[model samples]
Each structure stands twice: as C-alpha cells, then as structure tokens.
Target: MRQDRKSLAWSTLLEIDSQPEGPLHRKLCGALRSAVVAGRVTPGSALPPSRVLAEDLGCSRWVITEAYAQLIAEGYLEARSGSATRVRATAAVPNQGQPRSNPQISVPVEFEMLPGMPDLRTFPRKRWADAVREVTASIASADLGYPDVFGHPRLRERLAAYLVRGRGAAVSADDVIVCDGTLDGVVRLCRALRSAGHTHVAVEDPGWSRLSSAVSTVGLTPVPVEVDRDGLRIDRLRANTLTRAVIVAPAHQFPTGTVLTPARRAELLHWAREVDGLVMEDDYDAEFRYDRRPIGTVQGMDSARVVLMGSLSKTLSPALRIGWVVAPPRWAEALREAAVAVTPPPVIDQLAFAAFLDAGWYDGHIRASRLRYRSRRDLLLKEMASTLPDLEISGAAAGFHLLLHLNDCDAAQAVRRAARLGLRLVDLDQYRMSARTGPPALVLGYGNLSDASVPEAVRRLAEAVRGKGTGTSCG
Candidate 1:
C-alpha cells in the first residue's frame, strides 16, 4: 500500500551528489531549511531518524546528524535527547512583508452580554491547585486506571451527598453517572431514550437552540411547547402524549428567567406520571440566587420520572467539562450503556473534584461566587435604572443574566445596532423556534464584565436603542 503523505514526506532524503553548490552536509541542510521555509513541512512535525535518513541517502549517520545540528543551531528545528527531532513551532514560511493572496478578516468584539457565562475571574485557582495536589498525592495507583465509566465511586458518593443537601436532588452514588459536560449528558440521555422507542422529545419553544439541534442530531423530533410566565405550559404538554421526554430549566429558565410556579411544577410532574414520560431537569444556574430561596429541583419530588443534569459550567468554568446525570435506579443500566458509547472525562479531574468537594472547597467557592455575582447583579440593576428606566428586567434573583423586555423596538434591530457600537448582545427572538413570538426582549449577561464596564456597556446599549451615536471604544 502507498504510504501516507506525512510518512512519505518524512522519508524523503536529500540528493547530495546532484547538488554541487557546497559540501554534502551543507546541501542537506539547505534542502531541509528550504522545505521548512516553504511550508511543505509544517512546524512541530518530526523528521526521519538520522540513521534511517543516512541509510536511505547512502551517507554516514554522522553527516545526517551534522546537518540536523546545523538546522537546530539556525533555529529552524528543535531537538531533545531521546526524542524525535522536529521543526520549531515558529517555522511557518515567512510572508516577506507581502499580504496573503486571500487574507482572512476578523471582527473584534467589545462588550459581550451573552448569557450562561460565569465570572471566570472568580475561580479559586489556589484552592483548586491545592485540592488537585492533595488528591493526586492521596489517590491510589489503581484508581488511575480506566475510570468506572459511570464515575469514580468516591466522586459519585461526594456528588450524591452534595446534590442531596444543596440542590435537593434525590440520588445516591449508585444512581449517578459522570459525563463530559451537560451537553454530553443530554446527548446520552436522548440516545438511550431513542433506544427505548422514544421518537419525540418536547422542548420549550423559546429554548436554547442547541438543545433542539442536539435532539434532531440524535434522530428524534423536537416538539416545541410554548412557555408562559408560569413556565412551560402544562396544558400543551398534556395535549401531546407521544412526546416521551421534556427538557426544562425550571430553576432559572433561559433567556426569559421565569421560575416554574409551584402549581405548574406539580402539574408537570403529574403530567409526567400520567404519560409515563421523563423530565430532563436542567438545574441551570441554581446556585447564584440573590433574592429568594433556591428553588428545589423536580428530581427531588419524583426521582423515578426526573433525570437531573447539572454542571460546573455555570458555577465554575465550563472548560473543566465536569457534570453529572442523576437518574432513577431502574435506568442505571441504560445510562451505563449510553456512557460507554462516549469517552468519559479525565479521571484525575474527577478525583480532584471529589477532593475539592470533600474538603468543602466547592461549597466555599459557591458561597463566595454567590456574593460576587450578587454584587454584579446589584450593579446591573442600578445602572439600568439610571440609563434605561423603561427597560423591564426579570430573572435577576438567580443566575448570571437577566431578561430585558424590549418595548417599542425590534430586538433583532437593537442587536445589530448594539453590535455596530461594539457591544455584543443577544435578544429573545433569536431563541424562538418559529417566527418571532410575543414581545421582543434581550438576555443581558453581566458575569464576564468588570464592575466599571457593566455600566458603560449598558449605557452603550441604551444609546444604541435611542438612535444615538456610537461609543468611543469597546473599553
């Protein structure tokens, strides 16, 4: 069989005899340097071994070594003892002051008001490092092997206890399955439901677009159920019995930020029981409530019919990719099979998180973050009150964002205008499944902004809405 491009490229040897410009080693060095500069060989790609290259070129190994050494001395390549010699990271072919034939253009963003983003600046790095070091020193050698796929037993136990106490989740260590992230858990849940003969899954009409896309990608239809002030309309859900599952963010509904009332919660749970359907409860951002008591999860009420998914994406950084799915004991086998279909997250992080939780660092971080975000929420309310008094906001009591109901203005037009003024904003109409429904609104996220910039960004938004001139700069 023909070799691959990378292997064939590496196997090529310099023809020293044909090139009479300089010594054999010099010629070899020139050829390799030219290849690197011309971009034929990419940076960080390993070259053939000196012995193999010399044998192929009918030269002594010392000659190849000398040429490689020269290239390394000239900063064209990198070499380390016992490791393959490779091109340097900055070895890309020079543009020589000439613009590329097809230059890619990039637009810079100034202020980002996108929702569901946590204040990454508040992540306790020192505490996390300590937890990781402690866990690494204490973890067993055997625990480093392939993880339990479901989750590490210690971490699962820790999470089960934490959720039960903090989030009001009804689960035990045996009923939990660790996942790469919330999206991973959702995908797995959908596939498992599909395997169990579910063809339709209901989602809120003005819900996260990615949720619907995930359902469609897994070969199941997404039934769009309208959401009211009280939250997902239980009556509409009752009208559709074929929908096998419904996903919700009840604690703090996305974009709109409405909490599911007690009546609606009970009605939805009763509906699930009657239809024999599942409720995928996404307890998104339930940790940062500022006004009221943290809403209890539906899973706490009926674990058998509810599969709760929560992640570090909101409370912690999304880059950690740590989340869990707490299911009923009967679905444990199905969830496990679903988990095996996808690669689990790194075991070390799982263990480190267990240590963090066990040491109470996780709870400490939550408390501190709650206070920090609450301050930001207060700042946002204060700024909006002064700049845009007519702006109606909701869902400020919980989560990192608030819902701005736009009156007498187009949400899409406002978004475009705000973007031109260097403010990144999202409107509610973008989240709808069909044509724009109800009144227009905006979901403003303040988690990523500093205290000083929050007021400026909102002021720019107000100016954009009022047809005033653009701001000076994004800063």
Candidate 2:
C-alpha cells in the first residue's frame, strides 16, 4: 500500500508541465516542491532514491540527483545515513523565483566566425563515454552522497597535478575550488572581493564584454585599462589607485591575440604586490598555440597575489560547464564559501573528469585539437594573402581566433555587408568596455571554418571591404 502511495507521488511529478525552454531539472524541482506544499507528500514520508526515481520518470539519474540536492539545500528534503531521503517539515514553500530572461537573440548565421568557440564537431565522444562508464561502475558510495562544497576531493587533486604540469600553475588540491565555468568563477570571485572591501576592479579595454557585466553584477565598478601592443598597460593600472583587483587574459588577449610580454608580467606582479591587490587570470584558449610553445601562466610567478581560473570549454565542450579556480591561501576560503552558497556542480561529472584526467585522455584530446586548429589557421592566412592583401592580420601566435585590422573602413558597415553576403563576423567595437572610440578592427574566428570554405569567406569579406572604397581585389 505504501509502495502505491509512493508511485502516485512520483506520478504527480511526471504530470507537472514544465516550460520546454529551460532546464528539465529545474522543472522537476518545481514539480516536487509543489507536491510537498500541497500535502500530497507529507513530511516524514520517504522519497525514492534518485536512480529509481529517474528510471520511473524516464530521465537521467544526474538530473534527479541534482534536483534532490537543490531541494536538500533549500530545506525541503532531508537524508539520513543508510536511509531514504525524506520530505522535511516546513510551513513555508521556498521561493524558486521567476525564471531569468533568455539572452539569446536569434539572428541569421551562415559562415560562423564568432570568437570564443571551439570545434564542436570533433569532440571525443567515445573516450568521454568510456570514462563516464568506468567512473559510474566503480564510484564509491560516498561519492554518490552530497559532494564537498569545495569540489570532489579526487578531482581537485587530479586537476592540481594537471594544472601544474600543463599550465605551470603553482597549486595544490586544497587550493582548487571547482566552478561551473570561468564566468561563474569570476562572479563568485567578484562577490568575495567585494566583501573584502574591493570597490573597483580593472579590466582590459576592448576586452570580453561579459567580464564587465559580471563585475557590475557584483556591485563593483569595472575600470577599463588600455591594452597596448605588449598587453595591458601597467601605467594605466597604476594610475587607477581605487582599483585593487584586475582580470586579465594574459595568455591570449581576447579579440586581439597578444601575449603579455615578460616585462609587463613582472610589472603586473609588482603592481599587485605594491597595492596589495589581486589578479584574476582567465587562461582561456592557452593550449592551442600554433607558432611556438605556449607561455607559462602569470599565476606561476606569484600565486599569493594571483588567482588562476581555467575551464575545458576550449579544450573539450563548453556545454560541460566544468571549470576551477586556484586561489591564494588568503582568498581560497572566501571563494569556496561563495561557491558553496550556490548550487554545486554534479559530483558524477566531476568524478568522470577526474578519471579522464587521470588516464591522460585530456592531454591526448588537446594535442588532436591543436593540430586541427593549426591547419585551419594556416589555411586562413594563406587564403587572406591571396585574396585580401590590404587587411592587416594579427594575433596568429596562439588561440583559435585572429584579428583583422580594417583601417579607416567602417567596421560596423563592413560587418553588415558580410552578413548580407551570407557570412557572419563580429568587429572589435562589440568588445569595448566603454564608448571610447578606437581604430576599427574585426575579429575572425577560424575554429569552426572548414578548409574548403576559408577562401570563399575571405573573398566575401574582401568584397565587403572593397565596397567601402578600399579597392582591394581577391587575386
């Protein structure tokens, strides 16, 4: 009889209609919360295990696990050792709040050259699947329980070693705090810094626009520092005494791919030391350098003053939403506390990643991706040389994207012209931190472009430039 009641309660969840747009786990959570409030599932009644409930609901176990974890965090559910999870006694239905507005604006895209994307076509599905299977089969019971708010212990240890050897980050497992992605890490870091009395944070001008948004969201001002030929200007940073924390993509500056010269790197550290400030390094796309070996990260120079953040978005799939922050001893606790205040990422995914890194599959995947990106970059440069000689290309040293300087030509007009010609591209103006004007430049991403399509795309862009009175020909 109790079994029937349990089935009926689970069936009510299945009947709950969720919006098709947002995450299914969120909808499941809503359904479960409503059931608890409506007195259908009384307090002290046991809920089915995540695996069994998922099977009955025709969903993934992780989905069910995540929903349960969220409810547990909200005080709607409670789990006891060696016992089933139970509905907690509560008079108030926790406010789930309204869903956030979707930011995606639908637009026509033909030849996609937008930056900050990796080749999704070549994702190593077989290896990832095998790793997931191995992890699930052998995972300890303790892992299936609530995960450490900091991170999965084994994954943290594995990531520490990997970052040290691969990226030259001086870190230990204790210092690593896993996050959903680089943006998530930064948001949490911003809040922690704000709590510690940082009012203004410095960002690179003509930088990733999302950085500014994140900073502002945490009630901190994002001061735009200029990026010169070498990298971020230390002179500007020094002048801005109010700004104590700065975010940098030192390995490869976004939009414009310039490395932070050794001298500037030293200056940045010195500035941080003098000001008793912090440097948040976004090591995005540092693994795929073409011409030479990649440079060491800024965090290796002075780990105490620098916090290193990185993710597999470039190396693997961004959809995975896995990243980590290795902070200094002083800042690690605050960052971890901030991370714990939010929903922790799934434990199973973290364990699978640990297994993947432990087996060296991550290294192999990076090598394969590097080769493909290098070939595409070479083909792009070759095509541009023959078809569009007037445009100056820069940032070819590392990363998947390159910058094309369109001197005097209106970048916005050229972009529209390219779109009309069935090619999609973005200009540097879109990445500016302020309304301040600078020379027009276009950021062309070759990560997803095919070898056969490179020449045609360049030709169309050249025509767009020629239309602006450049009079350059695609010879």
Candidate 3:
C-alpha cells in the first residue's frame, strides 16, 4: 500500500523527469523540487529509500543519492540517521517578497465598550470545564455521530425548559433548533421564511444591523419600522402592507434598550395574527435587568405567530457559538428542513451546555453576572452624571448598554474624538437605517468595561464631548 501511494505521489515528478535535457541527477533534483513546491508531495510525508526509488526509476543508486543530497541542501527534504527521507515540515513555495501580516481589524481597545458584549472575565471557566469533562466521560457513542440537524435532544430540552422558566417563552424541546449563534438563527429563519414565500421582514429602525443584514443576505428586504420609547410602533408595521414577517428584540432592544410595552406587545401580536405574519424575536441580552424583572418574551403572548431566538452570546461567551430558535409548530418543520444544509453546533458543546443547565450552574452564573453588570452600569451612570452633568442618559433599566443622548455635541464627531483619547464608542446612527432624526447619542456598553476604569472612561468621554484633547495616552 505504501509503495502504491508513493507511486501516485511521484506521478508529477515522473512527468517532470520525462524531459531529458540535463544531467540525470540534476533532472531528478529538479523534479523533486517541483513536486515539493507544488504540494504534489506534502510536507512530513516520507520519501522512499534512495535504493528503492533508484530501482523503480531504473537509475543508478549514485544518481538517486546525489539528487537527494541536492534537494536536502535546498531545504525541501530532511533525513535522519536511520529513518526514511521526508519532506521538511516547513517547506512551502518560496515567497517572492516580504511576508504579509494579518490585519489588525478587531484588536481590542484599551477601553472596549462595544454594545451587546458580555463580561468575558466573569465567564465561569471552572464550572464549564467540569461540565465538559462530565459530558465527555458519559456521552453515549451513539450521540457522537452526525448530530440532529436541529440540535442535540438534551440541549433542546434544557433550553426549552430554561426559556419557559426564565423568559416566559412558550416552547417545547421539539420546537427548538440549535444554531451557531443568534445571527445564525436569524439567517436560518429568514431562509425558511423566504422558502415559505415571504419577501419583506419588518425590523426596528435602529435595530441590530447584523440581524437586518442577515435578513437581506437571505434575499428578504428589511423594512425598518420606527421604534419609540414604547418599543416597536405597531402602526408603522401595520402601514407596511407588503411585509408578512418582522424581527424584534422586544425584551430589551439593542442600542435603544427599550422594552416592548404590554400594549404594543399585544398590538404587535394582533397585527401578526391579522396578516398571518411571523415574528422573529431576538431575545439577546434579556437576562440582565437592573431595576425590575426582565420582561417576558413576546413569544409567550402568542407562540403561533412568534418565533423566539436567543443565544449564550450575551449571557455567557460568544466563543461558545451556541444559540437556538424556538419556532411555533407551524414553522418548526420548515426551520428543520432549512437547517438540513447547515451543521448544528458541536454535539459535545451542546451536551456540555445541557449538563451546565441541568446542574444549575447556568442560572447561578446569570445571577452573578446580573449583579456584576448592574453594579458596573450604576457606576458608569453615576460617573457620567458627575462629569457630563448635562448629558441625558437613557436605557439603563436593562441590557449591557445605555444610550447617552448628546444634546449639544455631535455623536459622530464625539466617536472620532473619543478614539483619539483611547475611549472606544459607538454612535447611535450606526444602528439606524432610514430614520436618522433622533438626537445625536452614543451607545455605551459597560459589560466588558472594568468598574475601576469607569471613572477614567467617563473623564475621557467628557473631554471628547467638550472638544478638548488631553495629550494623555491610553494605558
């Protein structure tokens, strides 16, 4: 078998060697070099012994040895005292110029305050490792095969129960479809909706751009319905007659951080029922409410007309890549069918998460995260008030971020100025589509910001807002 494989591996070399213009040894060296450079002989693959190769090629052993010596000098092959000659592990096509370095597009800032980011430092590493070890030890061999396209049965069941108890979502394990993350869930649902003949998806005006972009990527137009202090305007949704679908973060909307009022929630459901539309609810970051109980999911109001989507991105770490869609029975089969072409989250991870939920570690983590984030939010609010007394802040009741309404300063200008002073900021307009008449504001996230850094962050932000540049470097 090895001889057969080597014969196939040397086919390219044989092709190169058939041309006989140079010394036999030189030709052999050139052929070997070409094979290695073109990856016909992969790195770390053992080359046949010189005698065997020479006999196969009908060449003198002296010719083979000289060729091997030449190629080894070229840094393409290596030989040990008693082992077969092999391709060097680092051998590759030689670069013609200076090697390129990866772009630093996402390097974290000294004060990274990106909205929707969880406090990664607070991730329960020990508990998660315990869950992983337990799952790996006991997972049935049958469970390691091609996973259920929708999700692991155990994770789906645990998620369904957790959603019901915590977010008041109306769901069952059969209704759950696990995905890579919330955006992934949105993409899958959008495909299912498109398959079901839907064309337009009504999204919040200043909503999460990633989700809206996902809708458009799957060939559906994202209609930007205006959101006010009361959450999505049902009247705006009703005016858009062409849309039979909508996506919302009703529990705690991103950027704006407004909860859908009971009245609007009811109206939105009524509109969905009237138009036979489907509501894709993004339940991102609904786990942290500082002042009151987190609002119940809109799906609980009318499960048939709403599909709830959530993930561990905001609750735990986005690195986990675990998310789920709780679809109503009407759309469950369509979602499952749409998921057929996509790979679900790893079964091991799914099982570990299930064990985490079962062990109550997830709940304990959430409780601890909520308290920590609430404290950070309070500190940020207090510091901002003290430093920029005139700045009006809103959306502090829940979620990982709050909006700082700039009455006099330009939000875009402030973001640029803040960057120079080592403060990372996101303007409210980044989330806006057609509607841009709101007051200039910055969306400040305190989730990843340390409590000790809050005072300094606020100080830098104040300098930026005031158009004052302090020469102090960001440490």
Candidate 4:
C-alpha cells in the first residue's frame, strides 16, 4: 500500500454519493473510472480502504468492495489480500490525440571540458564513510539538536587552524563561520553587506556568474572591475568610488589563472583601508598550484580588511558542502546574524569533516589530488601543443582549467559545432558582464576528463575548430 495516498480525500470520489441517477455502487464505479480516465487519479495511486470510503460516502462497506472488485475485473485497479487497493499501473488514459511515449533521459557528452568540476572518481569514499560512521556512533546527544548559528564549534576550530596553517590566513576559531559552500558564503556576505548600508559590490569583469548573481540577488549591484595579467586592476577598482567591497580570487584567478601580484595585493588592501571597505577573497583551488608554491592569502597580510572564503568543493568534494568564512572582527557579528537566516550544513557532516581534518586525511587527499590534476594538466598541454600549435593557451600553470585563446575565431560558433561533435566546451564570453571586445576564447576544464579520453577529445576539438565535419561521434 502506498501510505502517501491511502488517505486521499478526492472530492470526485466523495461526490458519487450525491449522484441520484444510478445505483450507489454503479455511480461510485463510474465516477472512479472517469477520474482515472480523465487523469484526476494518477496511475499506481492508492485508493482509500473499503471501510473508510464506505463511511465517507455514506454507503455500505459491501458497496465499496463491489465497486473495487468491478474495477479490478475491468483492469482499472489492482488489489492483493492484506494490502490496500491501487489504480492499475497502466490505467491512466493518455491525452486526446496524443500517443504515449517513454520519458526522455538526457545523455551526457562523452568528453566534457566543464570548468570548476573536480574528478569525482577520486573521492575518498571509504574514509568519508568511516568518518561519518564514527561520528554518528560517538557524537554527543546535545550536538544532535539545532546547530550553532555560526557553525559547529569543533569544525570551526579545525577549519580555523587548517586555514591558518595551509592558506596562511590569520584567524582564530572565533572568526570562523561554516557555510554550505563558496556560493553560500558569498550570499551570506552579500546580505551582511546590504544590511551594513552597502549598495554596490565590485566584481571581476570576466568572473564566475553564479557569484555575481548572488550579489545581485541580495539587492546589491555588482560593479564589474577588469582583471589583467596582474589580477584585479587596482586602479580600475579605485576609479569606482561608489563600490567599496570587491570579491577576488587572488591565489589563482578564475578563467585567466593569473596570481595577484604582490604590488596589486598591497594596493588592494590599501584601497580597502582607505574606504573602510571589505575584500572578499575567494581562495578557490589555491591548493592545486603546480608551477610554484601557492601564494599566501591576502587575509594573511591584512585580516582586518579581508574575508577569506574557502571550501572542500575543490580539495575534496562539492557533495560535502563544507566551506568557511574567516570574517574580519568588524563584520563577524553581522555575518553571524545573517547566518541565522540560512540553515547551516548538517552538524554530523560538520563533525565528520572535523574528524577528517584532525586525522590529516584532508591534507593527504589534497596532496594526492594536486598530483593527479597536475598530471592531467600536463597531458592536456602536451596534446594541445602537438595538435593545435597555432592556438595560444594561457592559465595552464595551475588549477583544473585553462584558457584557449581563439584568436579571430568565433568562440560561440566553435562551442555549437563542438557540441555537434560530441564535445562540450564553455566560451569565455559567457563569464563577461560587459560586451568588451577581444579575441574570443574557451575555458577548457580537464578535471573530470579521463586520461584515456584525452587524445580523442583533443582530436574532436581540433575537428570542431577546423570545421571538418558536421557528423556527431562520441569516439
């Protein structure tokens, strides 16, 4: 019996008793059949018990039983002893003049160069499962109730220590606030800014759209600040007097992968201090640097002016939804107040993550992931150099993605044609807030791409670029 629909109080079913034209059982049967045929009652839906329906419809139990039996004989319903009666799986009629067809399930592309996705195959399932099991077995009864508005204390302490030790951020456990992920942290920060009388937030011109969207969602306008080889142009940001707060990925900027130069970093902090503004540092994928040692965070230098945001989305898995915000002392209270409005991630998961960190599993996982991704990046660079030598590539020094500058080539058209060739690619223009003109480019991500698929994927990409064929192949 489908418990969900067993107590269904369908008006049509109850209305049969008011029908004065035919016998009670016959009327009930006709109404039920019409309901099923008309799609009022969905297929596989449980009908009410005979006694319940009889009492509700003011009819004898035998009448309800007789109608149910008749429907079963007509192949409109099914019944088993000791179970509730249910509509036949195929009893519902199709719409007039329409033929039934199987539901469509979308097939994924064989080779996807989607930016910001980590390879899911490497997730430490056993370790994570063990941590969860251990935490569940040993967690205190009091910890199972409502979570702390800021975060679980143990997780916050672990995150604070980890961030300071790894990312070089200056923060204590009191400054840490756990969030669902980077985007959730962004939203909470935006709301806090709005509450603090902020009207505009400066964002990177060609930046992650979802983060900018989060800014706009909180009723604060996102001012686009151009990013260059040195990272966010400090002079361009200084020009916008109305915008005080800015979000930046200093360790490795997205799309371009340019690290924020020390000079620009100093200038950014200066600007923040001058205006008493905040700098939201999105330290995403900072741990995966391949060419050199990852730069220490801006918050490490000036913790008072910066809010360091990081998460396990890249280092571990997005499914965990574990992220933290190291807020400045001035904004910590406001962010905590904003945190109350959003439901924090599960406390058990938080504790499990703390256990993972405390056990040094997180560090081990990051080291292994860095090696794996670096190999993939090297393979992709080599293939591109061998096949598409004429095409210029940038941002290959670090991170899961790199930029393929399509000089004079139409990136949008290339993406469309690539789709026809069973290749997935993203255009750089999609990330731009303004219609700035430059050589078009594609943001190619090789994180989730398998090593065995690299040669064929690059070959297909070459075909798409060369306008060779229109036929689609997943080879």
Best lDDT goes to which candidate?
Answer: 4
Report the error of model 4 at residue 80, Å.
Answer: 57
Clashing residue pairs, backbone N/CA/C < 3 A, model 4: none
Query: Each candidate's root-mean-square deviation in Å?
Result: 13.9, 13.1, 16.0, 15.0
Q: Write the per-residue lDDT of candidate 2 for residues 1-475, one digit (tens) a residue.
A: 1234355547555445853455778878778887777666767777887778888888887567556655664557754433566776542533344234311113345588888789888888988899889989999998898878788889999999999999998999999998887877887788889889999999998788667655654556789888888999999999988998999989999978888999999999999999999999999788988888877899999999999999988889888878999999889988766664565578888988998998899999889888889988988899888877777889846789988888787888787777767778888987776554578888999887877788888888788766645454222
Given candidate 3, what's the lDDT at residue 420?
69
Tens digits of per-residue lDDT, candidate 1, 1-475, equal 2123347444354334455597677788888887778766767777777777777778887567657755664557664333467777656576545544322212347788888788888788898888788888888999888778888888899999999999988889998888877767777888789889999889887887667656654556778888878889989887777896999988988877888989999998998888888999998888878887687899999999999998888887988888999988756678886565455678889988998898898999999888888898899899888888877777748888888877777777777777777888887876787555668788889888888788789888887666665432110
> What's the C-alpha lDDT at position 238 in model 2?
95
* RMSD in Å for model 4: 15.0
In order, the Cα lDDT scores of the candidates are 0.78, 0.80, 0.80, 0.82
Tens-digit per-residue lDDT, 62-139, candidate 3 = 577656655654457665433467777657854334335422222335688778788899889998999999999999
Give lDDT for model 1.
0.78
Off by over 4 Å in 2: 1-108, 468-475
lDDT of 1 at 122: 79
